[model samples]
Target: GKNALLLACMRGDLVEVQRLLQSDKADELFFVDSSSQNTVFHFACKEGHTEVVKELLRDNRCSPASAGLFRVTPFSIACEAGHVDTVKVLMDDNRVSVDC
Candidate 1:
């Protein structure tokens, strides 16, 4: 329930991010911030943290998302940010709407 970790993620601080998620109890990774209306997954995708994305997906609790579900999804955010790798990662989830 700490926003600092998610903020670090939004800022793309991989080192701090990992430190915060050292335990990575799935709940930590799945924490969604109402302020940003984003999960850590959304931040990783928006910031193009492809490796983080993969790590997140490895967790069964990491929910599949299409556009932030509030405004933009990870895939849509990645595409908008022009991160091809991140977009590709999102594309791997057939349930996500690439057209969005």
Candidate 2:
């Protein structure tokens, strides 16, 4: 159930995502959506949706963030997509590795 909701977020279905979020069934904003092969943050970063990314960060209910990072984290995706702002946000978190 949670995974499905996050998947909708990955596809940028903000409307459906908002609906799912409103349901309160998916309180975790950081849930990973494997369909895009990334976390919700990854999708927001890759798509250059700064507002969405900011919103997710503010939620505080997001996942602790993957440690393995699998090289698929928002920071990596942002770097790959050439979105500097996204990269900056993730990089700001010292816990997230960017040397790779």
Candidate 3:
């Protein structure tokens, strides 16, 4: 299921993340956990997986502003977890708003 993507991101598995991203599943990109509602991007950011975060963000389907459980955004989670590299990668995206 789409949960695979989230798990891969959480584990910082770049190879798996890349493999999954190549598949034709748009829904996977937006896949959210049942409890946390965290997307692949959210988990990747939270875990400080800079490469995974970069790969996820490169996907046009990835939503940098997407909010998860508790209305937490990927950027916010990254910052909260002190993922400096992840935050920097996200900030590099012009779509990310630090104000949020």
Which candidate comes out best when scored by lDDT?
3
* Candidate 2's TM-score: 0.62
| Candidate 3 TM-score to native | 0.88
Q: Rate residue 38 of model 3 by lDDT.
A: 76
**What are the lDDT figures for the candidates, one per model?**
0.70, 0.62, 0.85
Off by over 4 Å in 3: none
Best by TM-score: 3
Model 2 has a clash total of 0
Give the clashing pairs for model 1: 67-72, 67-73, 68-72, 68-73
lDDT of 1 by residue, 41-96 (tens): 78888788887776666656666573455677777778888989878877887657
Among residues 3 or more apart in sequence or in different chains, the pairs in candidate 3 whose N, CA or C atoms overlap within 3 Å are none
Cα RMSD (angstroms) for every candidate in the order listed: 3.0, 3.8, 1.8
Which lDDT tens digits does candidate 2 get at residues 4-71?
55566556666666666667666655555544546666666778665566556655555325532454
Clashes of each: 4, 0, 0
Query: Candidate 1: minimum summed lDDT over ten consecutive residues — where?
Result: 21-30
- Candidate 1: RMSD to truth: 3.0
TM-score for all predictions? 0.72, 0.62, 0.88
Give the local distance difference test score of model 3.
Answer: 0.85
Q: For candidate 1, give the lDDT.
A: 0.70
Residue 79 accuracy (lDDT) in model 1: 84
Error of 2 at 66 (Å): 2.1
